[model samples]
Target: MHNLNAIVVGAGMGGLTAGIALQQAGYTVELYDRVKQLRPAGAAISLWSNGVKVLNRLGLGKAVADIGGQMDRMAYYSSTGETLTEFSLQPLIQDVGQRPYPMARTDLQALLLNRFGAEHLRLDSTCVGIEQDEHSVTAIFEDGHRATGDVLIAADGTRSRLRSEVLGAPIERNYVGYVNWNGLVDAREDLAPKDSWVTYVGDHKRASIMPIGGDRFYFFFDVPLPKGTASQPDLYREELSQFFKGWASPVQLLIQRLDPQTTNRIEIHDIDPLPRLIRGRVALIGDAAHGTAPDLGQGGCQAMEDALVLTNYLQTTNISVEDALSRYQTARLDRVADIIKRARKRSDVTHGKNPETTKQWYANLKHEDGRDIMSAIAHTILSGPLN
Candidate 1:
């Protein structure tokens, strides 16, 4: 048992980021995870401008940049490979105060954990229960171990046990009816391109490829598959091959070269936006608070922003812990909820039953200059309780 402190559950990006922020704010912090070791579990993720901005403030920007690929432009194209719209990301970052970087999930985690140091991390400690009063929080782990802190942050992610304990079991995780298969591919000679994110949109399917570090290309595809479709090892390559066969240029080639052993398929799930993310001394962040579709690639970025904003509030306000939690919820709910709605709406448009409607919607999207839309989003994320 320690003195007044902040205890963070889960060593995922959200938890680690919060731990870093809290430590820097002069709070004693301990981060716990059930896993024996923290390894990059899945694949690559694009750290958007908002996420990088917070990391830069933490002085980890240069370290992270050392392990990531800088994206100069994001291009959207039709299923037939017709470029619909392209945006310059460099200037956008200049206006927004941060640049977007793409890197492996492991890379980002490693950098954060390295900075936090091993002594502050507790592995194999799963928080199964929590008790909180106005002044302190006590956590009970699966192994029957116990720890207490002044504040308990539930950054356990979408299926967070802490969230379930605080809000009761979530209504249910809504499945979007499509599964995404993602992995890194060795960029073919002809496929190798410089600093760009390319998205291919089809009737009910979409694929995106972004440059990660080195010659490897990070890729993912959202394909319409029946719910609970069990994937087998031998059929991995064949299944993806059939799904994207004859779709467009590079599709066939990418599928052919994909190694099933190295690939991962995940069913997408999201939640209806909630009106609040705080209760008592327990506060939520990341997917635990806002689980959105990856349409905008804002999932991790929003989590990072939540961390930054929450820490900023703690530092700026001389208020009590409960008041800080209230302020954090008030400041974060609307912006994050709006993003959730937007992500769901975009998913419906992209994966709607009607192919023609999707194409039409995309065409309309092309006509709209996205600068203003992006700027509005930037404003919401950067302007927190200060506004």
Candidate 2:
């Protein structure tokens, strides 16, 4: 038990996970969020084995399994509905010793909040600045109030104010030159198999459907577009219909069933890897530290990993707080940097930023028997600190 207090900014996955892990480590945790209501930023998260291990370690294994979607296979298809390659995820699951959970973002957030207790989370408090001395760190809020703690964690996400404070420079988020429209729809066989993660790719566009808990499908469509495009919240269905026009029937059906109100559309962006993750008594975690493209589906998973690893260092290290944080940075820097670079490459390839690379990838998928895909997944799962 550390017997210290932690002030965590942002009540998203990483922040809430940090709150729970720190509480378990005998630290009083206070979580603050800018939004009045803590709405999850995404529709669903694909919890790979590494992320699931963190939840299990937090004593939510059964709860997560009960609520998470049971994904048995992963299949890739062309835009015209022709099967490109398919593989059972069972072998990868066995190799990793844990199952992946494709869960709704709201459901996962509710679970974390239940575990960490909603009473400890303070909403409608936006963090504006941070100040720290040799003894403690203080989080300055926009509401003319401040909170001080033994340590402060900046998990405030991609546009983090604390990041600049920690690094002493204003960081810019790079536009990935694509737009993603995502939403949840009722799960039906005609749309996609309830137990499979399916993707349709062609013309530098991607449409994916994954079964989520409660008999629903989490779907996303990716398209190459200029950055800073205005969101068409009211006309999402119409835009999607046109964007994916003349594709497969499953995609059309899914689009037809989508409710415009629930569909979320946003331009994708990510920050370059930070030179460092800590300054004084403040440390950055999750998206604030290393935001990346969602092409690899590791964004939230990496955040969960951040929570567990940071907690482990704080609880197990007998060293000073600053020393422990430096250790955390040392342990995380290389892995996250590699993931960021890989995700960037993947985004480029998937969106046909380089037409030759995209063509090669599609060509390779035709002959892939899933071994190469499974090996890639296995390598990523094995590279985590948990292994």
Query: Which candidate gets the maximum TM-score versus the true structure?
Result: 2
Q: For each candidate in the order shown, give its overall lDDT on alpha carbons.
A: 0.79, 0.91
Cα error of candidate 2 at position 384, Å: 0.8
lDDT of 1: 0.79
> For candidate 1, lDDT tens digit of each residue in 277-301?
8877788899889888887778888
- Among all windows of 10 consecutive residues in model 1, the one with the lowest summed lDDT is 378-387
Candidate 1: list runs displaced more than 4 Å: 1-4, 353-356, 365-387
- TM-scores for the candidates: 0.92, 0.98
For candidate 2, write residues 1-387 as lDDT tens digits.
358899999999999999999999999999999999989988999888998999999999999998799899999999999999998999999999998999999999999999999999999999999988888899999999899998899999988888999899999999998999998999999988899999999999999999889999999999999877776678888888898999999999988888888888878998888899999788899999999999788888899999999988888887678888888999999889888888898899999999999999999999999889888878877899777
lDDT: worst 10-residue window of model 2: 227-236
